[model samples]
Target: MSVQEHRRLRELASMHFQSRCLHEACERGLFSELERSPGSAEELARRLHLHPQACRMLLDALTALALLQEREGLYSNAPIASRYLIEGTATDQGEMIAMYRRSMERWEKLAEALHCGHTPAPPSEPDPRFIHAMHCTASVHAPLVVEAVPRNNARRLLDLGGGPGTYSIRFLLTWPEAEARMLDLEPVVSIAQEYAEIAGVNERFEAVAGDYLESELGDGYDLVLLSNILHCNAPEGCQRLLKRAFACLRPGGRVVIHEFLRDGSLWPAVFALHMLLSTPGGDTYSESTLKGWLHEAGFGEPVVSRLEGTPSSVLVAARS
Candidate 1:
């Protein structure tokens, strides 16, 4: 390799430095505190209860990364950070950043997974912030996705493994007469229920706290949504889940899958690595692979769509 190419390899390896720095900034609420008031590093350290020297270094690093701005030694949120890193704002994604931080430990196990097929150890306790972090990520795209899916004048819907139930809430809003049943882990289902109540659609939403794959999901649904869940299973498991989805729908009912298609993109390709680190045999699949699974599960020809502003795509098909 040329001298410059060798240097680039080291740079690529060290890219995790920037990710760790950003994760720490989010964990410390740096952007939100800075948004409240621009302050010198010393003032920020005191207000945020950080070690003085370390805080100064972190603030300067964030400034270098353009997530924060430093003017005359007073640090404040950069515009991008102001818009998406502040807590409680409409587009605040600080929680999502935290979610990435939480995954750092799992990511570290990639070498083990590669050599020994090791899965990262699960968290000792369920994370309460995870569902909220997912909400932050989903809220932006839910409206677009829900609007794109034809409501089909149907009344019953099932959201399998629907985290935070943002899609279900949006579905209910789009189809005013529709009722939704969202199944997920107990804690996650509770958050979904809370979100549905907040959306004023709880009257039409039911929360089922159980395993999406094994739960006795009642039949006769007009729609079944498998959003972001397929990638957690191996092909065989996904086939089973798809068959389950097929059986739950009424005749002529539709099933919609929302996921990142491994379509020669850098994002889903890297995300597949994360799945390897975390799941037993999970990985993102291509669109053709997904269509084959749908067909094998007894669905008709599928229609594929990539959400205009997001990394996710949808596959829609109906039980014949």
Candidate 2:
């Protein structure tokens, strides 16, 4: 390789350096400390009870990375750090970043994972930290679903494989008379019930727990929602699910799928890598594919609309 190419490889391999800087800073509450006020390296070392010289070096590295700024011999978190890294903020994504590290650490086995066609390392269950992080994330995305799915006194809504239940809650809240049933894994269903109760909509929210493949979805729904769930399964799985959704809907009933969709040609989509990391068989497909599925599932021509301010689109089909 040329000199520049060799240097680039070295920089990419040093990815762990950035991860450690973020993780240690978060674990030590360094961002929160700096948010209160800038402090000299010695003062920071005393506050955090760390070795003064080592602390100064780490702080300087953070400054070099632009996560922090140094002026007048005092250090402060950068604006982005102060806004998104500090704990207790509505947009605090530090826990998620930490969780990413936990997952990425296992991805060091990417070669083995690829050879075996499976993740060589398994993540644990009852991962409450990841669950809470997902809940926070879903809450952040719920408003978009509410705005995308048209609501006009709908009596019932079915949220298929809805995680966190935030989308269903948002729907119920937006349309007071609407009732929703959430279908998901048992662990996530348990959490969803708690969210439903806390939202004071438990009476209108029912939890159906099981795998979507084997369970039969009951009929007579005015609206069926498959929000951000279709991409988790393969194309055949999506087809089966769509047909089942059509069968469960009342005649002329609406079925809406909110998903991170690619364009008709399926290029320039950032979330294609997401499928590589998460779903084993499924990958992001073009809007035309989704429209074809909706039509093949015995629905009329579907209308695809792009959601504003999000990497998502809504495909609405009417049962014929």
Candidate 3:
């Protein structure tokens, strides 16, 4: 390979160094602290109980990463980090960073998992951290997705596998006349209710604690939303889930699917390997494959749209 290609490969290999630095910053609450109180490295180190020199080094690294800005020996969160890294902000993603940190161990076991066939069996109740991470990720994107969805006079909708119900809650915000029903595991649904209550949409939201695949989803709904749900299952299971979603919709009702579709992006291709490491049959699917599944499930021609600035895509199809 040419020297330029070699340099790029080296950068790719060591890119985890950057991620680890950001993860460490999240662990230490540095970004949030900087947002609330921008100060010199010495002051921050004293406040956060870090070694002075080490804190300065970290601060400089984060500044280099553009997540923080250093001005005249004082440091503060850059606009990007200020918006998404500060705790309790509407777009906070600290929990998501922690969740990714926790998943490192699982990713480390990829070789063994590949040798064997699957990762360890999932816990009966998912880690609460995972739910919180999903909430953070979803909350950041909910507005974009909720806007892209064609309301189609959807007075009622089903959020299948709606972890934390972030999208559903946001939908209620815009579609004031609409109500949302979310179905998931008991623990996840309980957490979803908490978020719904926090968003003040619980009155119009119903959280059902059950497996959506096997549960009885009442019919005649105006919409069904499957966000980040399809990629968790094998082909047969995905097809089955789509048919179940189909039956739960009324004639002319809409089904909206949101996922990290493989659309010639580096992220989705890598995410496919993540699925291989983490799931039995999950992978980043392509648009054609997804369209075929929707067609097989008896839906009319589907319209697909890519969410700007993200790998995730949304597909909307109608039941005739």
Candidate 4:
């Protein structure tokens, strides 16, 4: 291999190694320990009951990864790690990382999955761990979605496949007079209800439990939301769902889709890897596909807006 190619390979190996270390540290609560008390490697090893040499090497590696800092032999978690990576923090991304681990394992068989034109096994429900991951991730993204949607008190919003009612709750908070219905899987309804109650909008928000494709929706909603739902279905399923959403709206109603959309070109489909591992028939949709769907579904003036703080975008399609 050329020298540059060899250097890139080495860098990639190191990156994977560092990611593995982060996962291990997160699993073992090492970041939490450093948050409570900064210590030397020997001290941390004693506290964690790990081998001193191994702990030292790991801590040094983490320092190299910029996850920790060492000052005069004292090691401490970085601000980013302490604030967001620690277990008890609201922004703790451990659950998301753990979910990614499961998804990553499935994605390792990407070549086979693509060749078979099928996704790997679907996970059975009653999975508290996975559910928690979903809730945590939704909680992280809800605020952003609420901000992106056009603000209006008179708008009746429907959060289709709105897992955990995160976006719905945030919208209710943003506009107290706004009423929302969160439609999602039957099992996720309980989580959504809990979130609505916690957000103090249970009375205003209704939780609808059913499959989106089969559910009979009511009309007259000013805004219909489909956040992170399209990626769970195949192209046909998504097209059908969009058409269904379009039909369930009154004149001048708008459909809002919050998703990880790629640019017009299919180059660098980042979220494709996510769909490949997680959804049975799901795939990331492009802007053109979404715009075309909107047009075919009888929506006029489709506008795409990039979300402020995430890799997500909002597609607003208004009913004529």
For all candidates, what are the clash counts?
Answer: 0, 0, 0, 0
lDDT of 3: 0.90
The 0-to-1 C-alpha lDDT of every candidate, in the order given, reads 0.89, 0.80, 0.90, 0.82
Least accurate stretch of 10 residues (summed lDDT) in model 4?
A: 262-271
Q: Which portions of model 1 miss their true places by more than 4 Å?
A: 1-10, 88-90, 120-126
Q: Listing every candidate in turn, what is its Cα RMSD in Å to the true structure after a full C-alpha superposition? A: 2.1, 3.7, 1.7, 2.4
What shift in Å separates residue 89 of candidate 4 from its native position after superposition?
Answer: 2.6
Tens digits of lDDT, candidate 2, 1-320: 89999999999889789888888888899989989889999999999898999999989989998999999999999988988888887678786777766766555655665577655324424366666666676776788777876675578898887777878988888888999998987778888888888889999999888766668788999899988777867799999989999999999898999887877433325355444455565567778888888889999987777777667778888998
How would the candidate models be sorted by TM-score, starting from the highest? 3, 1, 4, 2
What lDDT score is found at residue 274 in candidate 1? 87
Clashing pairs in 1: none
Name the top lDDT candidate: 3
Best by TM-score: 3
Candidate ranking under lDDT, highest first, comes to: 3, 1, 4, 2
- Higher-scoring candidate on lDDT, 1 or 2: 1
Q: Which residue pairs clash within candidate 2?
A: none
Tens digits of lDDT, candidate 1, 1-320: 99999999998999889998899988888888998899999999999999999999999999999998889999988899998988787688988888888788888787878898767556634477988888998898888778668877879999998889999999998888899999988778788989899899999999888887788998999999998889988899899999999999999999999999999988899999988887777899999999999999999998888998788998889999
Model 3 C-alpha lDDT per residue in residues 69-98, reported as the tens digit of each score: 999999998999988888777778889999
Give the CA lDDT, 0 to 100, for residue 283 in model 4: 76
